[model samples]
Target: MADDGLITIGALARACGLTASALRFYDDCGLLVPVRVDGATGYRYYSEAQVDRGVMIRRLRGIGVPLEAVAEIVDGDGARAERLLDAHVAELAERARAAAVVTRMIKEEIRAGAVLSAAALAAAIEQVRSAAALDREMPILAGVLVESSADSVTVTATDRYRLSTRAMVPVRPSGAAWSVVVDAGELGGIGSWLRGLDEVSVWSADDALILAGGGTERRCGVIDEAYPDYRAMLAGLAPVRTRVVVARDALLAALEDRGAAPIVFLADESGLLLSRDGSACIAATITGPRTELAFSPTTLRPALVSAIGPEIMLDIASADAPVVVRSATDGDLTTLVMPTAIMNSKENDA
Candidate 1:
């Protein structure tokens, strides 16, 4: 009956420092259920692994978490659950503005004093911070997705018009394999805080993420909605019909120089063209077939800015297909620009 990796309901309650009545209430409410039950004896048994979840449930209830919200968190919808907690934290902050009430109390209980821990390189965080969708049309795009696999983590963002990604290996290798869509602003805060450090470690609770390092501990909310299938979008891309290499700085400068003019793009056998008001043109040398693609400058500039390298490859399949942008220096990075046509004249650009 002892140390068999399974325990009676009473033992589980005691193990998590909760009382029998409270556990029974939680079970009845459909929040946490025992792993096994002895129907004949009318007794329940819980798995040892569930101890952490039980403790989390107890702490959440103590803080006045609503029954529905608590179930959301317990059921692995932490992002949505975290948003509810954040509302509670905001109310608490207004009342106790100077105190670390939410930060200290919730972090300790959620972590159970064991240091909820995961690590990622600072370089990757910066990439995600920069790529966060600025346009608010798709609210969920406002966050960066941090996805972990057995050997790597990918940080990505998109704005429907443009997509950016950075993939890298984690430093500590915890194999926790957790994924979350975190607010772009929060991610930027993390990257800024970790600027001088080579690496950073973060811990996630059901409703919040505790960032700990450099004598600074802060809590931020997790995004609740499901992230878009950006990986699928990036996977089987259109064929590259015209792949031309140009200096990243040159292309960005060209895009930047178009002032007070209808932005236009003309890619031909000689070069890529950017012209404003038919006054002058900025040309990036190219060695591809003559291809005229018309799209707004706003749709493409982000990819050029993110490339940040000596050379950039603009992969184009047709006038209507998405164009792929790549940095010559970093192969692991990529940005895709969705093609669009102007209302007035696609012919004028060509």
Candidate 2:
């Protein structure tokens, strides 16, 4: 020891099991600056009491905390620092969970191999799509909503949260109008079949939607009742009265940063309100505000994340009603989101 209350930088590094260069880096970062520097020899010294904090800094950095975050942790109140750490840990956990699900799906697909029938594959695709939306508690449902006409065949699924409709026209098409509701699992099988071939033939028989593709056939049950009057819903929507040009990624990032789900819609005021824990609120600017209606960040964020568009157009009736979001690039895609009433603007002052 150099003195009763001090140690040379080298001694401190050895005691903390950190390289000298790492210590210097920490000092440079203001994370663990030495207490004194000798003017003559340029030697550095640290207080013995810094050993615990040094160890903590090393451990935090080992776990991949950025230098700036490490500085915040070191200087901030214990509770706030702990909250940041916990949030990061939670994010890691969510990512791990998502990875595990994908891994399991890949493994299952491998096990099934080419032996899996086309119908089975289509069904699998449908299920995965449903799982992605359902996991988020979005009310809209997805299925092989089949409609057969003399000219073409249409299969569609919409969450209303964010509408995505995919259609395939069979080459040797069945020219009949048929409506069916296939479970996600069954739709996955149909999706699998659809993938194997450029076209598929589908028919409804005995309450099942039968899809035949690449010589493999799959069948799924029809939904009991007609789908909600989706056409009527669309008709009820007011025309686009206001247009706001926003950078899709910037707005999306901001919403994600605030943990709000993105919803696309026209609002009376172009503004975003983020509500957390069901009460705390944060307000953000909507690129255009006067003509369009306002939307909750919670609803808009998810839609933005799911949107595959360079620009989104929102159509709204008023600030208090459901808003429709249409993709500028894709005319077929639409998203409908009900706005949460804003009783007081002060709630979202942040």
Candidate 3:
């Protein structure tokens, strides 16, 4: 008997290239449920739409993925699915390393570079690389400055208006310090691939920056230009006269759909008010005196999105000074977003 447009379990198994028994097991586990069931005979029927999901489950299980992990990958969000696959791949690599494979020993070459967690490197790159300038005249500003020292690895990028810097402790730091400016677009494009590996080694070779991990290496040409003295700029920041702590997501959402217009932020004892003609009040913990600061919503929103935690702290020296945005809990990433003029005080920076 035809079960409307639904296919029987045997047909679904055949369509998805899985055995009927395996489909029954997945059905019993609730990972893949049939669209309809004939209660009289207890026969299950699945829609054609479920064929793709069935094939995905079969493929994932064929690679030795556990039933529970496979279920998550099949049912979870894209990020969760990717993370599960990455963890499984890492586990397989560990198994290969543990295997007693016979091999001849060769002299190992000690490459001058820092070894760090691939996911950490990817996150740091995401946090800072957005600040790189896309100007054609200054090609050097189009790349991110990556520096490795005896203790830590740091990535910094700036577009003259805003600057973002993040530092992380390397798993194995090089004995000597090295620096290279790698193209931001190229580095950012491989962030997903990098996150799949356990560890990555980064070093400069001649005119290119080499990132090697998991038996794979990606080489990107280095810009032969002197980067701005960002460290000195950091050291010369003015004393903070006002500090405000606010919910990161709420503030980010407020900036959405506001267009490219500049938004005014008024911080006082009451709380914080965001206004760009239309006003919205957000509860925030305010420190210091009442202050009004205006900033381009496009420029300021990215800094908030790149912030780590739920709460973010803003330290402002004055109305026209750069505002430092840092996570309330994590201090590894710091972003300085320059403020624009409010109204008739100075020229609009928006």
- Cα RMSDs, all models: 18.1, 28.7, 23.8
lDDT, candidate 1, 1-350, per-residue tens? 33556788888888888998888888898877887777788777888888998899888888877788788877867687778899877877686864577677765554432221233345555544565678677778898776755566677888777788877655544346667777787766565566655545555567665567667676767788899898788677776777777787776776676553445566765466664243444456665576666666766765676664689888888877778788767776777877776435554555
Candidate 2 lDDT over residue span 274-334, tens digit each? 3322232223234334532345675566555544467766555566666665565764445
The residue pairs in collision within model 3 are none
Which is superior by TM-score, 1 or 2? 1
Q: Give the TM-score ranking, best first.
A: 3, 1, 2
Candidate 2 residues lying further than 4 Å off, grouped into runs, are 1-144, 156-173, 188-193, 245-247, 260-302, 305-308
> In candidate 3, what are the lDDT values of residues 105-143, reduced to their tens digit?
111123468889999999999999999997757888898
When summed lDDT is taken over every stretch of 10 residues in candidate 2, the lowest stretch is 276-285
Candidate 2: count of backbone clashes, pairs at least 3 residues apart or interchain: 35
Candidate 2's displacement at residue 317, Å, is 2.9
Error of 1 at 323 (Å): 1.4
CA lDDT, every model vs. true structure: 0.69, 0.58, 0.87
